[model samples]
Target: MSLSKIKAPLALAALSLVMLTGCGKSSSQTSKKQEFSWSTSAEISTIDMSKASDTVSFDQLRNTMEGLYRTGKNGKLMPGLATSSTVSKDGKTYTFTLRKSRWSDGSKVTAKDFVYSWRRTVNPKTASEYAYLFEGIKNATAITAGKKPLSSLGVKAVGDYKLVVTLDRRIPYFKSLMAFALFFPQSEKAVKKYGSKYGTASKYMLYNGPFVQKGWTGSNLSWKMVKNKYYWDKKNVKIQQIDWSVQKTPSTAYNLYQSNKLDALSLDSSQTKQLSKKAGFQLINNGGTAYLQYNLQNDENLANVNIRRAISMAIDRSGLCSTLGGNNQPAKTFTSKGVMYVGNSEYTSGIAKSSEAYNKYRKSEAKKLFEKGLAELGKSSITVSIMADDTDSGKKTVEALQSELTQTLGKIKVETTTVPFKTRMARREEGKFDIMVSTWIADFNDAISFLDLLTSNNSRNYGKWSNSEYDKLIAASKTTSSSSDRVKDLQQAEAILLKDEGITPIYYISTAYLIRPEIKNVYNDNLGGWQFKYASVK
Candidate 1:
């Protein structure tokens, strides 16, 4: 994501005046109700939450649906369709009391909607990349493996408004998981009506949340949202409608923002410093992390703990961030900072400390480690392959890394490769490369979401990295009843993961958006993408 772009507020002022002039003719329609819309960098990949994998698809579905719970901007749990929920003392069972809400089609959204959605997401036929998210549901694993019928899964509807969920073990983040798009309620009617095309576009879906997706033609360059009268909490919604556009290039996005086509847009580092001085310009520091990954499954050299450790130690994180030119924080941990808290304390960070800090990036340490790693692998020389995106930032980072490692490590050669985003993902899934630069954004503000990916059985564990002890620690943390105990167990798991060098923690990402001043009340939560539900133009 090359986010470098800047737009002057003077240009935005002109565009806003033009937009307001146009709104004068549409004032009658605007006066009848409230509404706001904004453009995004990417198009909605898909609307079916059940099968959607990437952030873009999930964001669209999030607005059009509801779940048992939802996370607020502060990252706290809040009631969504479910007014209240109860958990058994044993922590294995959960009961949800649903609030009366009607879908966009005027049909009641019930416990059955949730059950159907959950089952559909987990069914092998659906082939959802997120199928593994239901691993804790009773018999869900079996059902996903095709050993049992969907009904065998633990979710059951007591009635139209009550839902019962049984879990194989106690998962402290169960409610948080429900808040994700994958677990949002689904209408079987909508699915059956749309058949294969369900969620492919706006026409194929229904909205149950505070905003109804309007004017989204699946492939349109722009879209709009209207307030959903059907939302249970519609009364609290402030804005009425939002107009949005799609601008993939940050430079183009900046131009749109200047033209008042967008209220706010994410800016790159260059834009940040310049825009920070502008009035009404605010930078939101959200939680997301980016990192370089070495495929332990393919490279015998990187598979050696010393080589991996030496590689991790070789990079100057602060220098790298300076070269990249963003508000990106030098990552001191595998999990992103500000993502989760244990008691009043932030999660522990720093893999092995920066090599520059320890003065260990000298050629002596690199050569020693390289020789030691090569001796262990019974090879005279090692060739490591690096696959990365072709973005300007990516090319620069890879080039710098290629130069640094080759100069430092004697007889150790590093090769760089570039691939498009989708093709790179395919190669990753097939475990086709040696070293790859990859990143993980939080699904719902949980430390485990990233940590759990390294588990042996996780599909996202492309390197097939496994440590039984690490898995046991994570599992124990989930099942433990006490928060204190769970945190301790999780800390232990984190320690093990870091010590073993499964992944090289890179840097925490800072999302920057440049918005036109006319847009107001756009909701942004760290757990999900940007939201326009309560947005309106001035």
Candidate 2:
């Protein structure tokens, strides 16, 4: 799903406001019967995998349409559309064996569907936001750049059941990538039938996964996903339906959960403080990092390394984690914990102590750096605007940062701009803010998923920060034949990024949520959020 939706890491400010506004609201169960129900603070953007970039759309895409593989419990990859696959010795080619399956529209699913979908996503005219994920595929980059035809792409259907793929390099995590939404197949006939509005309404799309969405107009705060009778493994689908409501206030959603209206609910700081001891309270370590992204292209002041470093060190991260209180931990490096590993050793654990210390809070040192930075810029004062989503936690984060900036740098002024989740991301891409809080969720299980975003050429490198040595490290990691060398290259690259303080590391997020004790079989993938395909109500 939308691994990038900020992960509900923080909750709203006024519990009283939610209680008052939601006072007379009845449980969702009062109006309709459903096996499971939940709420999201953010809204779903699109169901089309090619256009969808947020977590909500990813979640919806996983349920209504399937990829080559599916994520099972504990984030393990399981067979979905493809029953099995084989890879060449050098890892440049893959061949998948398709299982017998039918789309909701009663047409048999075929290998050609995957080829058409992939070609459509990378086609320059289509302009899918996630097409960069196909970089290693032959001609994918050229096709996206308008230099080659989509026909030149390396994927082909060897008859109706066999799908072949060729890559430019060894992709160790390709299987995991195949499980992501960007790689999901689409029906050519359906795309041609719906034209430009294929994913805007429930009726315009076809379902091949566990559920079929109904009654969604693409903007409503509520919707339903009914079990797809045509799903290949329908016999194993335990839940008949899932109901979703978009609720921004944490207390309001918690109330819905308490009344048996919802099967699960996300907790804010206040809610977690009161309920962490209760049964069925679960903490989800999503392995995502939230950080401060500098507008390297627009803000001349932000280009000064000393100014960025001063700002990075001013905040009290340990105290911040204590106040926020949902198993949150200060980020010591760019790549989060439990994400990258070789055997039992974590990548960050290898960071030199001096390099790792840059992430800690040091008020006095920051004050000194700020004075020196002011001298270097020859400016008496500066104002910075911090942009983030319009959620309870975002408000709190801004307040904390503003407070810290004032305490550490008396000459600087701090301002905050908040908006809806989708709008925040859009503004970020347009480079409209001085500084913005951005979250990176793992696209696959590899460390490179987090490392590749800032490599100068990537469109997602909104900050416009560049370092040749760091780029070389990443490039070497990708092309080299040695596993040990790749890991070492990544280790060196992270150290370099941290030393430069390219982005200020805040903390790694853990989703603190409440679930009904009787609910069973719900699964969380490598990215945060649940997959309800196997969920059931006791």
- Report the number of the highest-lDDT candidate: 2
TM-score of each: 0.85, 0.93
lDDT of 1 at 345: 54
lDDT of 2 by residue, 96-195 (tens): 9999898998898899989999999998788776788898898898889999999999999999889999998887678988887778889999889999
Q: Report the lDDT tens digits of candidate 1 across residue range 428-512.
A: 6688988877655566667776677777787667776789998998778767788877777777777777666777766665554
Off-target runs (Cα >4 Å) in candidate 2 are 1-3, 7-34, 342-346
Q: What number of backbone clashes does candidate 1 have, counting pairs of residues 3 or more apart or in separate chains?
A: 22
For model 1, state the Cα shift of residue 33 in Å: 9.1
